[model samples]
Target: MTPELTRDCQTVADRLRATGHRLVLAESCTCGLLAASIAAVPGVSQHFCGSAVTYREQTKVQWLEVDPDLLSRHSAVSAPVTDQMARAVMRRTDEATVSLAVTGHLGPDAPAELDGRVYLAVCVRSGGPGASRDGRDDPYVVHAHALRLHEQLRVQRQIESAREAWQFLVRVALADI
Candidate 1:
């Protein structure tokens, strides 16, 4: 991992710990990269609950409990699936205060949809007064370069985007909490 990414993950982990929150991740296209980044930080176990690398459609359904009908209707890349992934991970861990989900196509060739078109969903459990009687849901996307490039460059850019995503999640989580 790059120093910047490591630092970002550490920053988010520290903030969540300070806020008395626990974190979890559900990942697809980015595989375990996001989880790995978070766990790399020292003392991550203090606030990092767990993560699921639900890379396959079946895994998303079986492990994350994503709705089969929703997956069949919109495919896993759609917003509903992303939201489900986030919520399911939160439920599965049963310890996370905040959960983050990421899904997308990282391709050497363009996808039917744009490559590097990533969807991120953050779900926060409701607590305290004025917290949503329900939970909270926020979804957004980050677009990164999609072209075929040197393997090193490709990995580098993905790490960069992952760092940015961590930062984005930090801002969102703070606001939500």
Candidate 2:
């Protein structure tokens, strides 16, 4: 990791710890890199709830309870699947106040249709009556409303870079919190 990224992660971790917030991660293209980065921080165990590396569709379905039909319809990289994965991680941990989900095709060879694509969803839980469909839904809604980023690279390099990108995003989100 770069110096800036390391500082970002530590900053986010510190804020979460101070706020008494817990986090969980659901990763696909980035594997478990995001989780590992957060875990590297000293005292992060208190706020880092857990993580699931749902790299395969079956794993996402079986472990994260992502709807198989949704996966079939939109593929694993779709916003809905990412949101579902985030929700499942939060539910399983039972203590996560924030959850992050990532899925994407990390290489130029990742099918013409999916080349250089990435989808990220961050869910933050709020305490309130009738929160309505969990806070994961809010992130999904925003995801649908946003303009996504796109970049092209070799498949092998993309996969490796996606991990770094996801970790960077985690650090940013932690800072925001």
Best by lDDT: 1
Please state every model's RMSD to the true fold in angstroms.
Answer: 4.9, 4.6
Per-residue error (Å), model 2, residue 139: 13
Please write out the lDDT profile of model 2 over residues 31-85, one tens digit for every residue.
7767777787898988888789999999999999999999999999777888788
Model 2: residues with Cα > 4 Å off, grouped in runs:
128-177
Pairing residues by index, what is the TM-score of model 1? 0.80
Q: List the global CA lDDT of all models.
A: 0.72, 0.68
Per-candidate TM equals 0.80, 0.76
* Each prediction's number of clashing residue pairs: 0, 1
How far is 155's C-alpha from truth in model 2 (Å)?
9.0
TM-score winner: 1
lDDT score for residue 167 of model 2: 54
> Worst ten-residue run, lDDT, model 2?
139-148
